[model samples]
Target: MNIRNDQYTIILLLLFFPSLGISQVEFFGYMETEYDWMEVKESTYAFGYNKLRLDYESFPAEEVSIRGNINFQTYHGQTIWEAFDFLPFDSLNINGEAVHSMPISFLDSIYMDNLYINAAFPRFDVTLGRQPISLGTGYAWNPLDIFNQKELVDPTYEQPGVHAVRLEYYINEKCIVDFILSPDTNFTQPSGMIQVKSNVASFDYSVNVARKNHLYPFWEDEDTVSTHRETSFIGGSFTGEISEYGMWGEALWSLSSNNSAGDVSYGLDHTFNNGLYVMLEGYHNSLGAEKDGLYDFHYLNYFSGETKSLMQNYLFSLLSKQINEYVSCSVFIFGNLDDNSFMYAPQLSWEILQDVSLSAFTAFSSGDADSEFGIQNQSFRVRMRAYF
Candidate 1:
């Protein structure tokens, strides 16, 4: 979501020409603004940004539909942020101090986020062009999704669209077969996925297979060529409610040219009668490392958001409560099981008007100075969004 260029906006003017007097056309969007303040061990800095998102939806025919979303953003103080720039600490520890070096330049961009069309056939539905493709049921980590990564701070935020074609066939009322294909030029081969989803008893289950071309994502070297690797994935997930609590689990086995790895996550959530909700989840990655000293471990993956943790095992939990009808509060904690590093974040939100809301959040960490969570900064943010 932090992409700062809009060179490929796809045809902004051409798409509008066809929607001109269409009876089924609809347009809606939102405006969002955010301000952040970070306090490192020695320095305090602040930055802010505002975004205007415009969306369009049209039903040109009974069986055909088109949707598009465009975003315009402006920044203050800084415009381009790389790995760990959101925090005061970045990758490549020169000496032993935290470094915050963000470039300042063109502080605005008009980016097209999504544009896609879908049509219904006799026995199947097809979607083409850039669209959203989400997989897995894990909240903090999604092992089954090889194409996109989630942000630990805002896991529920929208992801950048994938250029692909998707087809879905309904075998029965409770079963479906899905196929997704994307011809990525950066990969040695086209990436694709096949998923079979079904509901059994009271649980929903999915089994999927995917072949993807992956890059190292982020490395400290500036001259690093975009190295690519072909990876295969076999995964499954199940979601259901047993007794009074909700339960879900996802597992994936990854195979590369030279190695094999596995990732798994399990989560449980429940809401009490007193209007309080609690959730707990655990994740393990076979590829992650464990050590009391984090200097040798690569921080690029975590800073670039490919993974949320740098250790092999982790724990996450959340507690939320609703106060009246327009205000709510929540808190979540994440910990690295091996290094004893933990992060605590709390937030409060208020809806003062219809379709508009404001939220405030703060995050701090606890651990040894060189541990995963130790070198982090205490940060605060205030955000407001209004939907039309």
Candidate 2:
């Protein structure tokens, strides 16, 4: 066996063998199948993925516990077409003879190699190895995460970063403060930071500030250097239930030594007596007059791509109803006041068996600039899932 596999097996045995004399070991996991298709304005593609996760949590002491999670994925067919031809190839030739060979890129191999480890103690947690960092009101941009994942909602959002150490101190039942520290390494620079979060009856808030000690090269443009680019983000959100309806609103402002941006968003979700539910959401990035610096709204960072300009106004709505105990249907539509790019989604789901389900999802997009999966979005997918 390989070194890593040997280590994993050892850890698994240690976790269960020690509990044999006292208690039984606990096992947990989930399975999911997701199929997605993209029909852009000028192009289209289809892909699907399945994954499984196994984990164990054991307690040797009342206040102390060790937990581990291992996950893997099985991918189906994949393909991509380039708009312009760059690599010319008649055939794989060896010594001037034709031969068959497959081409691959960094991304093509990443799905097969994803692993992580996290251990927690009283009021503290430390995660070592590769992982993903997701936090804050900025759904698309996570300034607080140094090891930010390239895709906002990418199921494989896990990225390589330094060992993350975090601590939480409870001030009371409604408030708690936490801090996270991670040292820069080969993949990232030495970085450290802290944040404080509070919760009230119907409101939640957080303040985060951090520093990336060294001037780093910008990811969007490798040649450009982001020197002494001290950055800070302030964000908060409020959510409450009113007369059987759910409502929430959030705002985020990003401030850096060289740029500033703001965002305001609100949403309402309600369920009817007939087992039907509806949701309404709206957002305004800025006045649209102009800002001192660029504000990106893509899944990743602004540098990666231009932010979606909703023409100062954008609204989205969704309706869903349960057809029966084992089936359901839903539709989602989002548009702007100016008829810019729009989006539509129709979905159907069915329960295959206990703890297992299957679903189909389709989408269409058109208009002015919207989110990344803009107005030119369309796709179909089938999925199966199980949990324990």
Candidate 3:
């Protein structure tokens, strides 16, 4: 494996952390192997990877603490996984021009997913460096979160840490104000977010505002292009139990020089006394395209980590049950309501032994050939993980 300069920084820091006194430090991590395969019409593509993540936490002083997670991952047989293999489009369009060949850029590098030092004061907390930033209450989708994206196959997977500084000021036990800054290399076009969150009765509520000079790709003048734009967002979210059923919702109004749009998401979930669980959610994006104008959403602003679908309307449902203490299964159904395309995914998980788990997931798509889910015939993925 070839190590780059940035990888060296993470390696050195991990090596230096222990010298400060191992007695006060705690280390934990996990090793995992995952395989994924997909069928698109007559062609099938698959790949597998092994990953090792090590996390460390240390308290340097009464109010100061450090935390980090170093990640090392490698493909099973080959390093490069061609992006075109998964994109719905071909390598070349009708105009004989290459498209959808974007590089993943970081698949081969070993890096720190998170590294941060936090200092707690009497009334507030300050965190600096690369760290995890998450907000909003939607499980499968989060409209109020402008900082990160979710993966459809595994929505709960750990997200990559971002270079940011954060602050939290407490108003009381049930309320707080937060500010976050993600700076740019040029320093002239940075991103910032501020939020005020509070709990009332059986609900938690929050309102937020954010601004960023975002880099986005688009289809303009019949060609593809990428540019930077200054955008602002105002939004709110709430999560709570209503009549013993969990419910949550989020909404965002996105404004830019060219246009303004709104995105909304809401979900409801409940568990029965017999251990059966059910959930339903919906999403609507005023900026999304229609059936006649459908294309890859990855090129749109939402794919920059804002939303999940290409179309303007979508729905998701889930049913899950625990068979025993060590085994559970779930069935999921989601669709692009505009394109009339749907995907059904069933997942099964088993804890075979202590600290070891295995999971299997499979999906089937249904719709017209030109529809979103119809681009893929079927797919399956399997993963095994062990924690230490």
Q: Give the winner by lDDT.
A: 3
Could you tell me the lDDT of residue 50 within candidate 3?
88
Model 1 agreement with the true structure over 314-349: per-residue lDDT tens digits: 888989999989999999898888888788999999
- Candidate 2 per-residue C-alpha lDDT over 1-388 given as tens digits, one digit per residue, 9 for 90 to 100: 1133445446545654565336555777778778777665454656666777665566655654445455566566564444211112224444677644334321222121222345556555555433445554433333334445334222133443334565666666666566666665453555555667776666565666564443222543466655334445465556677788887666555555434555566778889988789988776655232322323222222333223342455666778899999999988776654445466778788997888888887777665333333534567877787988
Best candidate, TM-score = 3
Q: Quick one: RMSD of model 3?
A: 3.4
Candidate 3: segments with Cα more than 4 A from true spot: 2-23, 77-79, 91-107, 215-227, 255-258, 295-308
Give the better candidate number (1 or 2) by TM-score: 1
Lowest lDDT 10-mer window, candidate 3? 215-224
Give the winner by TM-score: 2 or 3: 3
lDDT of 1: 0.77
Clashing pairs in 3: none
lDDT of 3 by residue, 28-132 (tens): 999999998888755576778889999998888889888888788887543454555545565545356657565553355477788888899999999987889
